[model samples]
Target: MEARVEVSPEQEARRIAAVRRYDILDTPPDGAFDRIAALAARLFDVPVATVTIVDTDRVWFKAAYGLAGVTQVGRDPGLSTSAILTDGPLVVPDTLQDPLARDHTLVTGETRARFYAAAPIVTRDGHRLGTVDVMDTRPRRTTPEQAGALADLAALVMDELELRLTALRMLRVERELVVVEHAARERAERDRAEIAAYAATLQRTLLPPALPEVPGLEAACHYTTASVRDVGGDFYDVFPLGTGRWAFFLGDVSGRGAPAAALTSLIRYTLRSTALLQPDPCAVLRALNAALLSESADGSRFCTLIFGTLVPHPAGGFAITLTGGGHLPAYRLHPARRDGPSQALARAEPVSLPGGMLVGALRQADFTSRPVRLLPGQALFLYSDGLIEARTSRGARFGEESLAAHLTHHAATNRALGAAAIIDDLTVLLDSFAAGPADDVALLALSAATATPTTAPSGASGTAHTSLPLPARHSM
Candidate 1:
């Protein structure tokens, strides 16, 4: 008696033949296979679920959940082998009535199996690799739902096999070009690092390399990014117009970081282009605002800006015409020579701007202008809020009042010297305020001889000093 196995010689050979194709000998278990087995058990309500590989003399279980200790049984597949022999799925509703299985060892043996259903797990190459089957001790029937679920789970098993094979082939290809992958990864990282470096360099280049020079005029400035880790969208410019005249502007665009930095660069270049083409301070600012708003999307952003042109006066001084936006005012400083009770030659005033809306909120926008002349021993200070309002380590702010006083003390002194004193003192004070700066700072100061206040634009010989109102809605 040759062991009275339930499987026919043909079926056993087919099962063994199918298992040999995969060559997955002694492979460790994986989650995808285990999950399919578990789902089959749940769907069929079977006590045992298996992803089994039938081999030459024994049945090997790749994944078996819910069956205790025993990984596989060298069971005879007298009827169960129907799934393995067919290229398609094999479903046996009831094994008790089937002629081929009635006397098989599976039904008459110790296990006394009464029901069986198995799906042949085929590979993409049309080879039947194994069977994903669920087994129940009690003879039972299956609903259309249970049948469909079994088919679905079997398909998932086939997919996993296909994926594993493809991955194996890919691993072979990868081994052939190991050096290429290493080089590719290195090149990619280097490119990323270089891009970051370029952005930083571009940001530095946009800043004024040196402050402008106007004979007998005292000037100072500072510019900082609110986000040090990325590029910024804040800028200030000071340039001489070749004659005894000079032109300058300071502005803040909306946002911070890279996008803001990009816009910052655009605005810087645009201002330079517009300044050269159209020298009128008011026209250039208005044009820039209109161009920005018109070409932008519906939610386009705008900037707060101040444009100014300074021409030499016949006297030993320069006159400044400033067209205003929603920016903070420049502070004028006179000699604070009263440290020992001696009176100084002049007084100080904070430059006031027109009051209107921000640029992009409306279709038509207008800006105001103010004119003032700087004299010998007098200084005009232009600064963004980032400088005057710089937080100190003591949780205090270097406010407008303190800034005006500082200007008064340094007005009679050289422009570079005044800027150095302010930077040094402010830096130490900021360290005293606690941790770090919360915002960026920018400043520009000019000093020249004093002149009469009647120097208005040619369009208005005797009009009031303020020609227009400030635009309040300059949202980016």
Candidate 2:
């Protein structure tokens, strides 16, 4: 059988009143909360007191007097959220004044609570946490001195609230700094990737993808930049004009990267165009100088180049006319024969490429030309300063001699194969002599063969008739 539970009238009223105590919940805590709780207990000389943070159904004490893990606050007694209201101090003038007092097991008849007071706990921003509450078994009031002391204690609680709020702000600022640092790092990585990509495109633009063909002439060329970094200023080109004549050029700008690359491009197109219009090697060089000077802004940028023409040599070889504009002397390697080891052939000195100056440096420059018969089984070479001046291990230059010896050894090889070998050997030699070549290297080689018929002696034609007549007379 189920026992019947019955609720008493007075007991029910007190329970309803207890539930409407304080209203605060889900809020940040403050030092002010603890101070207020402690002050209330001391001022009233009570054994139980608290600054409670109220939730929907229960209240948690942020600070308490005479309490330990006393979280089951009020035991369905008074919920704290209701306490935050009531602007003035809630002073239980006397527990006896309570209608249902006798039913409030803690008060009413036994241990009759005659004293109580609660000051609402205030936050720095003025939001309430709960209440500073105190309770006693006897009714009492204090003098002015007592009241003043209580006020001082409450002020300390406010300070505590301010201190806790300040700490929260500091934590927020530190987190923001971490976020900012991460964003900056990502931006840096993206920038580096972009620059690397741009460098690749720039390299492709500066050099031709393949060599242009010229009839009667076999040609091979090699080019490389110091690195695929910024744009560089060196370039080389060979092309056929509408006429049978072929044009070839190699140039070096004073610097490297974008500015240098730009100039190199201008030179490449300009040289090719000028050669097509005027196949004269000297005139082409002169036009390039004038064009560069005309277009330049600061006038500080300039280029050194060698331009040349390809034509058939009457003696059964190709006669190449080369014009130099303060450029590195080109070399020619003849096959080793009665001559000792193969040796270098440029001219006694720089063939004066008059009327040509470094393109941008001066408006009126002069270039001069020299012709060398590149016979069958012989090779012609043109290179940039980046090769000879390449620093060696001891800080000395690789110079003209080392290049000549390599050319002599390899010049008889196929045009493509020979150029590659020369470059590779020079590269290794560079590492041996210096750490490595400090600059970009550009090299061009041309080879050709022409067939010729054997001829009889020049004086034989006049003597033939007299010899036949003398022989006939002797026979008669």
Best candidate, TM-score: 2
Per-residue CA lDDT of model 1 for 432-471, tens digit only, reads 5443445666656565533332232111111001011111
Error of 1 at 314 (Å): 1.4
TM-score of 2: 0.49
Name the lDDT value of residue 159 in candidate 2. Answer: 37
Error of 1 at 357 (Å): 4.5
Q: Tell me how many clashing residue pairs each candidate has.
A: 33, 31
Indicate the residue-level lDDT of 342 in model 1.
77
Q: How far off is model 1, as Cα RMSD?
A: 29.3
Q: What lDDT score is found at residue 380 in candidate 1?
A: 66
The ten-residue window of minimal lDDT in model 2 covers 460-469
Best by lDDT: 1
RMSD of each: 29.3, 38.8
TM-score of each: 0.49, 0.49
